[model samples]
Target: MRKLIPLLLLVVHHFASAQTKDERVKIDSILSVYTGRSVDGKGLLQEAITLSQQSDDYLLGQLYFKLAEEHLATGAYDSAGKYYPLSLTPLEIAGDSTLLGEAYIGMGYVLYLKGDYTQSLNYNLKAEKIFRAAKANKLLGRALKRMAGVFIAMKDYGTSEKYLSEALTIAEEEFDTINIVRTLNTLSVIYDETGDFKKVDPILKRAIALAEAIHCIRCMAISYSQWGISLHFRGQYKEAIGKYRKEYELNKLEGLTFDQYFVYQNIAEAYFELQNLTLALAYSDSAMFLAKTENAPQFIHDSYKIQYKIYKAQNNLGKALAALEMKSQYVDTLFSQEKARMQEDMKVAYETEKKEQLITLLEKENTIKVLEAEQSKQLRLYLIVVVVLLVLAAGVLFSRYRLKQRTAKLLDAKNIDLQNLNQVKDRLFAIISHDLKSPLSSFHTVTSTLNQYYGQISQADIKKYLEKLEVASKSLEDQMKNLLEWSLHQISERKLSPEVFDLKEMAETLKSFFQLSLEVKRQNMYLEIEGSIPLETDREYVQTILRNLISNAIKFTPPEGTIWLRAKTAGAEIVIEIEDTGIGIASEDFSKLFTLEADKKSIGNSPEKGTGLGLVLVKEMIEKMGGTISLASELNKGTTFTLKMTGKQQKQAA
Candidate 1:
């Protein structure tokens, strides 16, 4: 019976192992969809997460880890933080040491981003231990590299260098091109920051070569950006701008919005160094815009400082002072002492209130004692006085207690308000930064080119350059006008003026406005109207909406892609759809497509510049005019935006 039992158990173990292998294949298939394309897979991800939960398998941990990675990529740190622990729990329970190590690495990344370097390091160290025990060199290199970043952040450069060197050695041995590129770039940064400029370029060159060999756009971008920084450090402003522009173009192709600010700011600084104040100012504006979108206080601060320099160089004292003021305000936000002072004052007030209350009670007690001594024969009178004093004291104490509670509540509310204000400030900064960049970049490119080629060029070439400059200047002017209108709409509540206008005529006007942009991309647009479907809506608001929508379509749609503006009337509604064969939005982005709360920006097919505030404004205007907006998109396929508004004057129907 015992021998039979042992045989049966062995058979069950073999079956379970086979079952796990089968499960892994299925899980891997699902994971491929996530890792393969830039499509919206939030729904698929959630469904997979549900299936993982139901199965109660080791795949649950992997699903959680992938979800966490997705969140981390999107800068959703809180969501990433929540999922990392779930990953760790299941991996540990299943005794999957390999995945368990990855979970630690995931947690470490989340904590690092949250600015908890010590805790992040702990997680990375735990991951290192697991990877080392399993002899997983690939993952061990990643953990070691992450640990290097933690140490760098903690200012232990020696330890960081050591870890980085170890990671580099492992990456080389494993022939891990990606890790090799990463390690090399990081080492270059460390050396550059430490003023070992001689060593930086060679390291960056190697990183770039490796990155290029693998066709890794992100790694190449990083290397080029670092190269620009090294040049900027040495006052080689023109060369630095060249490198920075290279980085910017690569990042744009990859739609890496988060990293663009650094390149933009570096370009601005380069122009500033060259004493090309106009171009410097423009690039500074661009940098500030990108920085604001990211809510990166440091970048915003740097941008303002550059702006101040530009203005000062141009002898624009007023603008320089304004820039200085703006820079100072951001500095205050970055390192504000006001909250600490407020807390200290509150503490002092509470203590003083308590002391005052105690002193009052003691005074009352002394008064009662005196009365009792003086009125020994008049015991009733003394008792009456004592009772009155006791009642008054009780009333005062109750009032003070209520007041203190209110004070505490008020302080708590104020703190919450302050936190919310900081968030708003960050978003507002992003918006301002974004709006300032497009026109600025356009202006800078033109002016810089003209300055470079002016006297040395033929008259014909000069004329061409002048014409380009004129076009750029006009574009900048239009951008400024749009900025003014946007600012006015946001700053005050204005009544909308609705009128019956020729929808076809309005479309023609918009077509003219975006003609240059369309020609640039060689995109085709067709306006298809079943009838003259004119509506009574705010003319300016409708124009704004149509302008932004059409512009966006043109921006996103690749060269030779088609766009259709179709409108029809159904029941009491005029339905309009802007359809584009464009690089469509990912499904995960749908939730915030029209939300002003999200600083959502993506590069267009033109690699065009946009603040992302336009869509937000469009939604607000539509809602105000009692209209609805909806979108249908398939990534790399197409996007369709549908707008429905109440039909105006049924009697005047075409």
Candidate 2:
């Protein structure tokens, strides 16, 4: 026994030495061919693929997949997509589960970027099923995260949330910080949609913290963009604008036109709302330039809206209407673009499904051959062979089954995410067709009517009609704000410029504007300020935030419902609470409050149908002002919103 052990040890050593030499030779060969200033990744990948085929022959499959993946990273989507599947043929034959699944996922992601969302998802599912069968949880989580984004595009919020949550659990269990942050950003949008600001805000804060900790600029940009949008919806215009600006600054690199276009669009809206028309116009021009350059219909839609507002503000009614007409045209164009994406997505999904079924058929044939050989050999040999075959079959089938399950899970997630986007698309159309269209079309008609009646109608009648026209114009302006708010939230971040002001007076002014509204509802309204509520604040911002909240409460509450808006000193904090007896929110919705994700549904109440963004915007703005807002609500039992601003907030913290 001792002599045999020595012989085994010598053999193991020799094998290890030989393997080490082989590894060294392969590495040296790759380096020798690729090294030097003139090295080309394409050349290296091509050579590697060729050499892999000639060398060990076993590594060729993996090398092919690697070469394709490297190409994908360099934006050579066609090259990567082609080679990745070619590598898959060898991996399938070799039963190389690891490389096969990875290669499929790589192909899927590239296809998705190429606007082939269906193919991307199909491949992702194939990879997912394989990983699940292998119990490869780490890879499964990655596939789920990617699928979550695809689902978001499909307007399937529920499934997207499910996959994102599953991915988050896996990340936490594995201590994978990167996946955690990515999942959180995706999840936050859903929360924002359903008016779950509490959940949305904290998730964003955590995502930002994680991104900053790791110095991941891209993730930071995503977090900041989400954070800004949430803030914008909450009426935290200043902070939201700041976030958008940071995103713009960071993304001002080569191959970042898409990111910059959105940022510019947001900045224009933010500046417009802040009443800085010049800045708004500048950003609008910037957005338009990018839109034209990139052929992004969405950005073009936003640009025309901004230009319209700019012209209207300048009292250039002719230019304003022309811009509005242009905006309407682009809105129509963008709708078609989204439609095309949806159609392509469905087509690709169908085709990929067919291909996967074929792949499965081939795999099954292989399994059947092995089963037949084992079964024919049984008896005493038969019993032993049968058990082994059965076990192996069970293992493979179970792995395949689990992989399919996980792929289904990922697809479901992508569907839910797409549903959210679908809502945005639908809602955008709603705004254009129902909301803005009605008013702008009316604006044009009314102007024409007034002109037609000019000679026949009395000056007194004209004056009265002009007054009515003024009121109509006010409504138009208000409608335009909704679009502006949408644009600002989408594109910019916190841009607060704080100044010293009296909170009490601002509250009183808010109360004054709602006087008629209060009377109409027969609601009792109270403003409580024990002393001078002076703080460093932006007057217009304070007014807008207060107006939206107070008006919201008044609009929602039934007749005679009391609204208590109290501002007082609690240490160095000036807390403002707008409490009202209105229709309360459901508990199921608490988790999605601030998620502006494409998957979330925006809900509002009564005569004051809201942007579903007012609360989110308020939350964001208050936070930027070194303040905080909280919601205390009960369904049909009134809701209370509190905004607490810091007394000595700094100037440049954001």
Candidate 3:
């Protein structure tokens, strides 16, 4: 009977173990379906949690960890923080170091978000140690990156860079392109903050390229934004606008609404620098709308600041003041939020200390009670009282220190903002005063000469003066048109009105339009089109683009120079080229050709009056018409501007 009882117990144990294994598999299947999904998986996860409670500790811990991640994704940080810790004990019991490390990382992130940098670093370090021991290079790299982020938030850039460098090396070794790109971006940010801009550009370029290679849209967008910021800081507003537009397009494609808000704000600031008040106002408004929709006070504050600048530039004092007032309100709201976060961090720290004290006291009491009863009771009471008093004092001191630190940080940030705002204002004012005043001064000079010397001037001199006036008027009209068209292109109100147009006929029309300029410049223009090439695109946009390109060709070409306009069907596309046999652009100046900074530099040998706005407008129009433009130029040879657009047959086939 004794032998039979032992055998029956063994059989029952085997049966129970098998049942637990089956239940674990079921729980894992549930997690596989629901984890990381946006849909509410809480109810299903809860059911899994129930099933897991009686199963192996590893499965239970994994279920809890997944639940925490879901909560974290939905911004329910409190619930996430609560559940992450719930996973630790079960995972430790199961001796699953990998999941345990992941749980620690999750807790670290929660603490980091709560502004508990010290505790966050501790948790991340613990995870890093576990991942290192397990030879989990990917997780280890992630842990190191998290540690770096904590240090970055604490303004310890050197230490942050150290961790990031290590993580970057690990990612490179593992061929983890995503992590490599991410680490490079973080490193670039450090360089940017330290004002080592030369290092920033290469790192960001490499990161952007890697992101593109991996088809990581989000990573590419982030890299572009950081690059744009670097360019913006250097006062390259046109180049910065180009980068920001790339970011905006990617974010729009991915339906990332929140990211688009920041992109719009960035583009607005760039336009503001270029003194394009219309675009600045439009983009600022778009950012403001998104900020309001997202209920983001910091973004709202930033948007208002840009709007204030735009309104002030437009001489709308009332609107500027209103924007200023709104900005102040958001600033106050942000300050309040910061204070609240600090208080919450302090509260968390105090509660944590109290709990630790309680556990220590309980342990000490148990030890003392084993040796002496009365002494243990007195010692426990005394220890509790002393611990509480010390904790309270430390909490008070820490709160005061943190408050002072927060105030100083806020003051520093405000000072930087003020300085940047002042710089932007000065630049905008300088550009506007210089560009606008030049044309007006020319007009005043020509008109004054004609009015003052009407009787004294000969017929030939009067004709010359009248011609000068006409030239001034034409220059001002061109400038105004470029500004208006560029602004319309940015705000996206200029919709594409595509129609079938014969390329040769359009070339003839542009030739006729530029006949007078051609005659004055003593330049010959040639048109070549292959067998009635038909392009289906916005005619006005195409015309504007060609007009700008041709005008630029004429301006740069010396007397007796030749310009060629050619169009042909290439596969499903129509290719057009505007080639000028004049002093060509330097190879180094190619980047500056379609940018606002190009206005500051003379491209070719000829001394031409240009604002560089024409090329910028041409670029915008070509893009709007779903076409591309490229240029090939040599210093002393010549320059050719190429355009490729979809053919009418291709459009109709699609």
User: What digit string (tens of lDDT, one per residue) describes model 2 on residues 402-475?
Assistant: 53464456456656655655565565555555555555665687688888878888888878777657656655
Q: What tens digits encode model 1's per-residue C-alpha lDDT throughout 47-117?
A: 57643432443676777777777767765565566567656755765678998898899889878986889
Alpha-carbon TM-score of each model against the true structure: 0.45, 0.43, 0.48
Candidate closer to the true structure by lDDT (higher is better), 2 or 3: 3
Off by over 4 Å in 3: 1-29, 50-56, 273-275, 292-298, 312-315, 324-654
Candidate with maximal TM-score? 3
Worst 10 residues of 1 by lDDT: 3-12
lDDT, model 3: 0.77
Question: Which regions of candidate 1 fall more than 4 Å away from where they truly are?
Answer: 1-33, 36-38, 249-261, 287-305, 312-654
Q: Between which residue pairs do clashes occur in model 3?
A: none
Tens digits of per-residue lDDT for model 3, 1-654: 233333433322333446567877887788778847547687678678765544544676788898888878877675577668767866775678998999999999998997999999999999999999999999999999999999988989999999999999999999999999989988987886677888988899899989989899999999999899888877799999999999999998888988899889989988998999999999999999999998989999889878877886786755865776677667668766756754564464455446545644654454444434447665564444445434534644464456457545755775675566555445434545666566778899978988898899999998888787777777776765665566435434356756788778989988999899899878899998776777777777888888888888887888889999998888988889999987887778788877775564455557656677788888877775678899998876789999987864222110
In model 2, how large is the Cα lDDT of residue 173? 92
Name the 10 consecutive residues with the lowest summed lDDT in model 2: 6-15
Q: State the displacement of the C-alpha of residue 173, model 3, in Å, after optimal TM-score superposition.
A: 1.0
- Cα lDDT listed for each candidate: 0.73, 0.69, 0.77
